[model samples]
Target: MSKLRNGFIVLLAVFGFAFGSLSSVSTEAQPVRTAEAATTAQQITKINSTLSAKNKAAKKWIAMRESGRSYTAKNGNCYGRYQLLRSYLHYNYTKVNQEKTANKYVAGRYGSWTKAKSFWLSHHWY
Candidate 1:
């Protein structure tokens, strides 16, 4: 009976320590992407030619509010500066992919970044 009690105590201690260690790891931490790993401004321009200057400003405005222009930003299942769904990115979290997908998304849903910005203004999200 004493041995059984000792084993139970040891097992409890092990699990308690493991849980404590794991709990200290923050799940909300946003990993920073190095400039070399992130998409370049030139690459963005290459793919971002469709948006007018006004629309580009609107897009940047929305990105600032959404994720502080982070390429690796995450919120629940949303990812990237635009906070698009991970599924929309098809599990590809690359910055270029995020930009492309966000562009397509805004175009399909709002027809333009300016329109999306208007929606975000009224709803605080787009």
Candidate 2:
């Protein structure tokens, strides 16, 4: 009788622990809506500002703007906020503006057109 009682108690304890652990465990992943939205918005803004159809001057600006703001990682060789280091300029901008470097240097960073224009106005080198 005692052996049977002991076996039952052990089984109950094991089940209780398992139940407790299962209850404490979360099954669903929580979504970070705000952060995700901000990131997505930024990407969309970047695409619209830089990647979409551009005029010849805009394309030239993206390629050649080699001012200080143009560096990508600050550690790696990323030359522009658009991350154009050497290859992009060499392939695209250099030939476009063989006479001047003005079109090559970045006049703005990753911001709205207004912000970029403001940066250009203030920095004089963006």
Local distance difference test, each candidate: 0.89, 0.46
Local error of candidate 2 at 68, Å?
A: 56
Mark the regions of model 1 whose C-alpha exceeds 4 Å error after superposition: 1-39
lDDT of 2 by residue, 17-124 (tens): 998877666322224666676776665455345433443334435334444334332325544444445554563433222212222343334333343444645774
Question: Candidate 1 has which clashing residue pairs, if any?
Answer: none
Q: Could you tell me the lDDT of residue 56 within candidate 1?
A: 93
Q: What number of clashing residue pairs does each candidate have, in the order they appear?
A: 0, 11
Q: Give per-model CA RMSD.
A: 10.4, 13.6
Give the poorly placed runs of model 2, Cα more than 4 Å off.
27-126
For this target, which candidate reaches the highest TM-score against the unseen true structure? 1
